[model samples]
Target chain A: MRLLIEIEVRFGEFVLSVNESLTLDGVTALFGPSGSGKTTLLRCIAGLEPRAEGRIEADDQAWLDSKAGVSLPAHHRMAGMVFQQALLFPHLSVRKNLLYGWRRRGQRPGPDFSEVLDALRLAPLLEQRENELSGGEMQRVALGRVLLSAPRMLLLDEPLAAQDERRKAEILPYLKRTIREFQLPVVYVSHAVDEVMPMASRVLHMDSGRLQSSAAARVSGGTAFGAILLGATLQRQLDSRLAVFCVGNAEVIAFLDSDTPNAREVLLAVEPRDLVIATGKTDAPLNAGAMDCTVRSIGEDETSGNLVLELAAGSSSFRLEHSFARHSDTVLRVGQKIRVLLTQPARVASPIVQSGTGRDSA
Target chain B: MIRAVEVIELDSLWLTLRLASLSTAILMVLATPLAYWLATTKAGIKPIVEAVTALPLILPPTVLGFYLLILFSPSSAFGSLWVQVTGQTLSFSFTGILLASVVHSFPFAVQPMQTAFENNGRRPAEVAQSLGASPFDAFITVTVPMARRGFLTAAVLGFAHSVGEFGVILLVGGNIPGRTRVISIDIYTHVETLDYASAHFLSMLTLCFAMLVLSLVFIVNRRYPIRT
Candidate 1:
C-alpha cells in the first residue's frame, strides 16, 4: 500500500508543512524529537485535522484533496489510531469496549473478534472493567479494540512511551508478532530512536517540522554500540572464517560466525581506533578482513582527540576515526584513496530474511 | 399544640404540593434545551441571553408582580392579545398563575443544568465525534447521561422556588376561593380575617414542606455528584 500526504497546517505558534509519500509493505517509523510534527502528520492522515491543506491518498484512493475540496472524516477514513494513553472507556467492560466500534458501524465486514482477541492476548481480560486492568493489560486491550475496527492503515503514536521497562519488554514481542502476522502497514510515531529501531523498516527523520532525511536502515535489536553493517547474504559456514561486511565502500571480513539458521546478514563492531589508514594499498601482511578504501570526508572528534574519515567504496560509505599519534603516517584529504586493516575480528550471526519481510537475524 | 385548626389546613398544604409539582415538571421540559444551549453556545450574544434568563433573580418580587399584573389584566396589550388568541382574559386564572411561577423561577432551574454541562469537559464529546457519532447523537449519548445529576438539581430547585413564590402569584391570580386561592394566598386571607390559629397552622405547614424539598435537593445532589 502507498500513503501520500502533502499538507501544511498552522496552529497558533506552530506551523507544520510536510510533503512526502511512503510505501507501506512494512513498518515505517516517523522518527523525530518532541514537537516535530510527527503526531500532527499522523492526525492529518487520519482526517482528524480538517483545517490542513493539501492532498492525501492511500492505496490509490483519495482520502483528502484540498484542491478538489474533498476531505473524508476520521471515522470514514477507517485508519485505526492508538494514542499514548490507552483511553479505554471506564464505564464499559473490556468486551464491550472492544466491540464499541464494530457495533457502531452497523454492518461492515471486519477482523474477526476472536482472532483479534487471541492476537492481542485479551481474551482473559474480556470480562474485567477498564480501571481494573494494569497498564500493559489496558494497552493490549486498546490494541484489540483498534484492530477489531479492521482499519486499512494503523497509526500508533508512542504506544510504549508511557510504559515502564518491564511493561515495554512484555509488550514488545506481542507488537512484533502483530506486525509480522497481520502484515498490516503501520505509520509508527515515536521520539525514542531505540524504540523504533527494531520495529521500523524505513526511518523518516524530521527536525523542526521539516523532513531532514529518510534512510532505509537494517533493523537491529536494542544495543548500546554504534551502527552495524550487514551483508546482503550469508555465504557459507567457516570454522574460523568470520563473515565479512563492507562499511560505506571499504570491505572488512571478520572471523566470527554462529551456526544459527537465520544468521545471514552478520554484524561487525568496529572501534574507530582499531582502523589503520594508509596512502595506498598496504604491503604488510594484513588480517583476514581488510580492504583499500578512499577517504570521502574528514571531521574532528572534539570529545576524543581523533580525526574522523568518511571512506568510500564504489557507492557505499563508512567512517574511520583515529586518535592523535606522535608519528602521523599520512594526512588524509577528501577523495584520497587509502587502505585500512582490522587487527582483531569479532564475528556475529549473519542476518537472514527470517519472515516474509527482511528481518535482521543479529 | 396540635389543634383542629391545623387539621383544617390540609387543603392548602395539598394545593401547594400540586402547584409545585406541576410547575417543576413544566420547567424541566422547557429548561433542559435552554440550559444546554446556554452551556455550549459560543455566540457573541450568549451573555445577553443569560442576563435575560436571570432577570427574575435580581428583580424585586413587587416589581415583577406589578408588571405581570399589568400584562395579564384585561386593559393591557398582552391581555387583549391573549383575549383575541384564546377568547379569554389571563388575569386571575390557573394558567396565568403557572406562567407567573415559571417566569419567576427560571434562573434557578437553568443555573444548575448549565454548570453541569460546562464541567463535562469537551474531550468526551470530541472522542464521540471521532467514533462516528453525529453532534446530536453525541449530545444525547454522552452529554445528557453525564449531566444527569444537573437535571435533577435543576428540577428540584425549580419546584422549590415556584412553591415559595408569593407576590407574583398574588398579583397575577388574585385570592379567588377554589380558583386562585393557593397556600400562600390562603394564609394571607386567614390572617386578614383575624383567624390567627388558621394562619399559623398554614404557615407552619408551608415551612415544613419547603424544608422537605430543600432536603431532597441536598440528598439527590450528594448521591450523584456531577462527574467532571
Candidate 2:
C-alpha cells in the first residue's frame, strides 16, 4: 500500500508543514527528536486532528481530499493504533478490553482470535487487568488489541518509548514477529537507532516537521542508506565469547560481546561503515569475524569521498564504504579475493520467521 | 396543631413537588446540550452565553420577577402568544410558575454539568472514537459515566432550588390557594396570617429537604471521587 500525505498546521510559534508520499508496507520506522511532528503526522493519518488541511490517500481509499471537502473522523478511519500509554482500557479487565475491539471489527476478516492471543503470548494474562501487567506485557496486549480490530495499516506511536531497557527488550521482539507475520504496512515512531535497525525494513528520518531522508534498511530496494539487514542463523553457540553462524556455509565466528539471542535462528545487521576490507586475508584479531569474498563492484561516494565496495560471500552480497587516498594499498579489482573483518559483532536480531502460534521457543 | 392545617399543607406540598419535578426534569434536558457546548466549543460567543446563563444567579429575584411579570402579561408578545395557544394568560398560572422556576434555576442545572464536562475533557471521548464509537455514543458511554458526580450534583441543586422558590413563583403565579401555593408560599402565607405553627412546620420541612439534597450530593461525590 502507498500513502500520499501533505498537511500543514500551525501552533502558536511553530508551523508544521510536511509533504510526502510513502510506500506503507514493510515495517517503516519514523525517527526524529521530540516535537519534530512525528506524533502529529500519525495523528493526521488517524484523523484525530481534523483542522489539518491536506490530501491523504491510502492505496485507493482517499482518507482525506481537501478539494472535495472530505475528512473522515477518527472513528471512521479504521486504523488500529497502539498509543505510548493506554494500550488497553484502564477501566476494563484484559478479557473485556480484547473483546471490546474484537467485537467492533464487524464482518472483516483478520488474524484469528486464537492466533492473536497465542502470537502475543497473552493467554496467561487474559484475566488480568491492565494495571496488573508490566509495561512490556501491556504493550503486547496492546498489539493484540490492535490485531483484533483488523486495521488496514498499524500505527504505533512510540509503543516502547515509555519502558525501561528490560521491558523494551521484552516487548520489541513481539512487534518484530507481528510485522513478520502480518506483513502489513506498520508505521511506528521511535527515537532509538538500535530499535530501528533490527526491525524496520525502511526508515523515514524526519526533522523540523519534514522528512529529511527515507531509505530501505535492507539491500537493493528502498529509499534511505541505513544498515543492511541480513538473514542468518546461529549455527553454533560453542562458548560464552564466540558463536558461529552459517551465512551460506562460511562459518562466521561472531564475537558475542553482550547478550545474544538463544534461538539458533537470528538476524544479523552489518553496517557499511563498520566493516574493514583488505585485498588479502591478514592476521585478524580474536574478537572480529573475518570473511573472504570476491569484490563485485567498486564506486566512490560523491558526497563522502569513500570507496563503496560491493562484495559477494557465498550467496549473500553486502556493501562496505571506506575512505580512500590516491595510493594507499594494493589496487582493488572487480573479481579480486579480499578478507573483511568486523571488530564489533553484527548485532543479533530476533529470528526472522518463527512459528505463527504458541511461541514457546523464545 | 398539625391536624388543623393538614389539608392546606398537603395541597401546597403536592403542588410544590409537581412544579419542582417538572422544572428540574425539563431544565436538565435543556441544559445538557448547552452545558456540553459551553464546555467543549472554542466558539467566541461562549462568554456571552455564560454571562446570560449566570444572570439569574446574581440578579435580584425582584428584578427578575418584575421582568418575567411583564413578559408573561397578555399585552406582551410572548404572553399574548401563550394566551392564544393555550386559551389562558401565562401570568398567574401554574405553567407560569413552572417556566419562571426553570429560568431561575437555569444556572443550578448548567454550571455543575459544564464543570463536569470540562473536567472530563476530550481524551476519553477521543479514545472511544478510535475504538469505533461515534461521537454521541462516546458521550453516552464514556463521558456520562465519568461525569456522573456532576450530573447528580446538578440535578439535586436544580430540584432543591425550584422547590424552595418563592419570590419568582409568587410574582408569576400569584399564590393561588390550590394552584401555585408551593411550600415556601404556604409558609409565607402562614407567617402573614400570624399562624406561627403552620409556618414553623413548613419551614422545618423545607430545611430538612434541603439538607437531604445537600447530603445526597456530598455522599455521591465522596463515593466516586474523580481520580485524575
Which tens-of-lDDT digit does each residue in A1-362 have in candidate 1? 77777788888788888776667667876655457688888888877776689888987889898899998877677777887877776556899878766666656566788888888888889999766898899888877777776677678888988999899989877777777777788878765544565566654545457653232333322111122333433454345555545544555665553443444344444433345555444653455556566666776656665666666554434555566421376666788767766555534423333332334434
What shift in Å separates residue B98 of candidate 2 from its native position after superposition?
A: 2.3
The TM-score leader among the candidates is 2
Candidate 1 regions exceeding 4 Å error are A22-26, A53-71, A163-166, A169-183, A204-362, B1-109, B167-228
All-Cα superposition RMSD per candidate: 10.0, 11.1
Q: What share of the true interface contacts does candidate 1 keep?
A: 0.15
* Candidate with the greatest DockQ versus the true structure: 2
Q: Which stretches of candidate 2 lie over 4 Å from their true place?
A: A87-93, A120-142, A164-183, A216-362, B1-4, B214-225
How far off is residue A58 in model 2, in Å?
1.1
Give the lowest summed-lDDT range of ten residues in model 1 chain A.
Answer: A219-228
Q: Candidate 2's residue-wise lDDT over A299-346, tens digit each?
A: 776767767676677655655656642245778889988877766666
